[model samples]
Target: MPVNTDPKLIAGNSNIPLADAIAKRMSMHRGQAVKPIDTRVERFNDGEIFVEVFENVRGEDMFIIQSTSNPANDNLMELLIMTDALRRSSAQRITAVIPYFGYARQDRRTKARTPISAKLVANLIAEAGVERVLTMDLHAAQIQGFFDLPVDNLYASPIFALDILHHFQDMEDVMVVSPDVGGVARARELAQRIKAPLSIVDKRREKAGEVAEMTVIGNVTGKRCIIVDDICDTAGTLCKAAEVLMDAGATEVHSYITHGVLSGPAVDRITNSVMKSLVITDSIEPTAAVQQCKNIRIVPTAPMFAQAILNIAGGMSVSSLFDNETLEPIYESLYPNS
Candidate 1:
């Protein structure tokens, strides 16, 4: 069979909305409607997953859109299984478009008898016959090295920076903050982009998911603090950091987190926290609890992903998407009035 030059998108059940949004944005980019490949992902009585690709994928460029999010194990398995099926169907090329790559935090072994699960997951994807990977805002950038295939790690900083620029007219009083010392670089990038001062939250963690004490490393007094981080799991760190910033005389507190893994009482914690609002990317689908939370807002990442897909398919540079000139149109499309 002859190879189909057009890109074919297939999605697991992890984030159907985001996949559909990407397809819509891709359609706009191509000047023609591009729909996702018809596929069925179902479950057996014992919770085993079964995937079927209804369309002819032979010799076509295939991109599977799936986020290893809540129920991470299941979603990850679905991606691997789907990749196996695509490989068996003789797809010309297979790219895994993962908005949120789970098990990323386990990139290294901090303790004895620990496994570097991120590398293991990378191996799983490659062994399943994926040719490339496209993901966003990985917890650790070095995780890219774990994969032998080319991995394009996209950033949400540009999107957050533009959103901040549009919303906060008064840049003088705005301060970008890192929730912890490790995130200082991420926060500094955004601060530099928006031309705002940078600050860090010095916190000591006694154990996982718990912060003992948090100190504001810089003067947040009389400033509207914007905390930046990669993930918000239990919300303990973010909530505590916000409290510390407020105590340090911050006028208002907001957060721009790349991934909203809001698990285990996170929604309740954020709803009652002193933070003004929390802006997260739609990398992972928002839950009903997250949707009902008034202060939580989601920024669609579909436009960026769509552009990246188009570039990849055309043999164009994916890094060019980061430029303001290129991003302006995407940002504007998301917030047309701005």
Candidate 2:
């Protein structure tokens, strides 16, 4: 039998809305409605995961859209099991599209006897028979080397730059800031795109999830500062960074984070902090508190994901999607109303 080349999308319970949005955007690309495979990822009473794929995916190009976000273990297991099911079912190729890769921060062992969980997770994915992996804005770029298979790491800078351009009319006074020194490259890329200056927050971390002290490295006086980073967990770092910027005489502070892992007190901090707005992507499903937050906004990544999926399926260059000229058309196609 000839191998089925049509792309088939399957999603776990992590972010169904994002999966559906991607399907819709892909449908627009194909000029026909492309729906996700009828798969059910349910749990047993004892907290075991059970995944059932109703559609025939045999010999098809299968893409599983699942983010290893909150409840990271369960979501990761779901993706692995789903990949196993597809491989066993004789799918031609299986790609795991994880928007938010969990345990990415543990890419290295900072101390003795600590495990590099990111590499371990990469090994698990490879062992599960996944042929390819597509993820976005990894906490550390080095994590890509851990994967044995082809891993397409997409960037959110294109999306974020577009949003920043539309939101802020005066680009001269806008400054792109890296919440920490490590993120300076990410922030610099966005700064170049918008023709803005870049600044780094000099910070020292005593331990995980805690900051010892922070100081501004550049003049933020009378400037509209936008902090760019990959993750925002407890909001401690971001909130403190905002405060430091404010203390440095910043006219206003804002943030464009890729993953909004707003855990305990994150929403509260952002709500009461000096930041003007917080923009994040729909990599993880937002909780009710996040949705109700006044200053937080979510931008859809479905269009970019849809374009990437199309390129992969068509054997096109994925990197071409990053060019401003290339991204403008994609942004227009998916978000015509905007």
lDDT for predicted candidate 1 compared with the true structure: 0.93
Give me the runs in candidate 1 sitting further than 4 Å from their true place: 1-5, 336-338
Q: Give candidate 2 misplaced runs (Cα > 4 Å).
A: 1-5, 333-338
Clashing pairs in 1: none
Tens-digit lDDT track for model 1 on 1-338? 34344788999999999999999999987789998999999999999999999999878899999999989999999999999999999899999999999999999999999999999999999999999999999999999999998999999999998898888877899999999888888999999999999999999989888889888898999999999999999998999899999999999999999999999899999999999999999999999999999999999999999999988887889999888888988878565644
Best by lDDT: 1
lDDT of 2 at 20: 98
Per-residue accuracy of model 2 over 97-209 as CA lDDT, tens digit each: 99999999999999999999999999999999998898999999999999989999999999998888887878888999999888999999999999999999999999888
Clashes of each: 0, 0
Please list the Cα RMSD from the true structure of every candidate, rounded to 1 decimal place: 1.5, 1.7
- Decoy 2 TM-score against native: 0.97
